[model samples]
Target: MRYSAGHKLETRERLLQSSALSAKRSGFSTVGVDGLMKAIGLSGAAFYSHFSSKDALFSAIVERELGQSLERLSGQGNEDRERLERCLKQYLSMAHVEQPESGCALPTLGAEIARSDVQVREQAEIWICRLQESWAQILQSESLAWAILSQCVGALVVARMLATPDVQRTVLKSSHEEIARQLAVQRAE
Candidate 1:
């Protein structure tokens, strides 16, 4: 039986969401199209019916995931100083470090995207710009915004890599505290 347009759209969305979460947990390159389709309870044949290729699916998932990140950040409200501090606190929280699958895609997907297709790179660039912009708006200084984002991403990457929970917590707490101090100084200046 043929699915209607709406049903097809919903199916495609389901696939993208599942793929995005899976890609976060496992590197995007590691996830097979068949596995992703199976996770969504759809046949592998139906995969191409929505996306032209795996790269196309990756691009869609990146866009969707980035949008979700932005929405979450925005929901935290617009207090520049408070928002920047909150962003650091939340990003480096133990919960975020321990849960790769449910966390922001930037830290999880950055390495994979570095070796990804040009289309994926382009999408990543867009998300980076959006994140930078949101951060810049909060800090009111492009340089400071870039620094905070860099530090946050780097801290998360390192913390995630560490084998010991103590090391991970140390990295997260120290980095979060440092960023908070730096942002506080920026505000005072």
Candidate 2:
């Protein structure tokens, strides 16, 4: 049975979404194309119909996950300190840590992306820079913007790594407070 163009596109989207969730929950390299297609009720052969190769699929996932983050971090026309603070909170929250499949892909996939093909790394890098520049526009400090990006990703990574909920909260709260304080000091200067 043949499918319509629209049906094929929808199937591709479903595959991407399922792949993203699986990649975040499990490591990207560990989830085989065969398993992913089976999870979505499609045969492994159909995977090639949508993606030329698993590497291509990984590139697509990087694009999708980071693209969603870049869109969110871009914010409205107004790039104010308040908006930055809100972004920080959202990024640092326990909810984000607990739901790897639904949250930012940086901390989860950064190492893998670093080791991926140049195209995949570039996909992640371009979006990451966009996010940093967005924050820099508001902060009026490029160095601080880079620091903010690093700190958020680092804190979340640590928070997710620790097994204790209390430690996770402590990590989140401490980093959040320190970052807020830094911003306050920068504003006062």
Candidate 3:
């Protein structure tokens, strides 16, 4: 049976979403087309029909994930300071650090992207820029935005690499508190 164009698009999107999560949980390099297809209940043959190559799918996934994040950030408008704080708290929580599949793709895939092909690297760079821009608008300063972004991402990476859950939680809480304190100070001055 032949699927309609809309059906095909939906299937492709499902594949990309599943692949994005799988790639985050298991390094992107290790997530083959066959495994991704199996996870989505599709035949491996249908993979190429959706994307020209794995790299193409990776790029698309990056776009989708970043777009979702941007939309989430935009919803805060300008007055939702408490909402922003909660978002950061959730981002650096132990739950996020321990769950790679549902966590932000940046810390999970950053190392692999560094070694990946140009297309993937370019897409990653675009996502990073979008994230930074969104944060800059929220914090009202480019420097503070970069600092918060760096601290959040770096804290997650270190927390994940640590041996104990307590250590991870401590690092995350400390980083979150420090960023929040500094941002408050900046607003005061």
Candidate 4:
């Protein structure tokens, strides 16, 4: 059987999107190549045609997820304090806490990324630093940017760890409040 010219690219994209969501919802290391491919309706052997290896797919997922995050968080060339605040509110929300697969990858995948090879870690670092750079410009302090970034991701992770919704909401609220306070202080300075 023959396929269209775009068939390969479309199949690859499907694999990437499906695999990324799976990795975010469950740990990347927990899923093998066969599992990843199976999620997208392909056999395990077909995985190599799209990606050289599982690690390659991981790198691609990191790049795609972080790139989307950077776009949503940073906006385009005109991010300001208000925009950054809105981004934070969304990032630290209960919806984000409950929906790991559809949201940012950091909270879910940070540990796995840290344990990945140098190349994968480097891919993540590039996007992470760019995100920080965007926030730093608006916040006017590199340290503050890092702090808020850490706080946001940490808050999500902590919120997800709790069994009760009330405690989870408290964790999100506290982080949001503290981050707002810190931003207010920075603005005053």
Candidate No. with top lDDT: 4
Task: Give per-residue CA lDDT, model 4, range 2-79, as digits (tens).
Answer: 767699999999998998899988889899988888888889998998889899999999999999999899845564
Q: Is candidate 2 or candidate 3 better by TM-score?
A: 2
User: What is the Cα-based TM-score of model 3?
Assistant: 0.91
Q: Estimate, for each residue in 41-92, the C-alpha lDDT of model 1 and write its tens digit.
A: 9788889999999988888878888777777664246465566566668888
lDDT of 2 at 100: 92
Q: Provide the lowest-lDDT 10-residue window in model 3.
A: 69-78
TM-score of each: 0.93, 0.96, 0.91, 0.96
The regions of model 3 sitting more than 4 angstroms off are none
TM-score of 2: 0.96
Q: Model 1 TM-score?
A: 0.93
lDDT of 4: 0.92
Clashes of each: 0, 0, 0, 0
**Candidate 3: tens digits of C-alpha lDDT, residues 124-166:** 7887787787777777778987888789889999999999988
- Find the 10 residues in a row with the least total lDDT in model 1: 72-81
* lDDT score at residue 165, model 3, on the 0-100 scale: 89
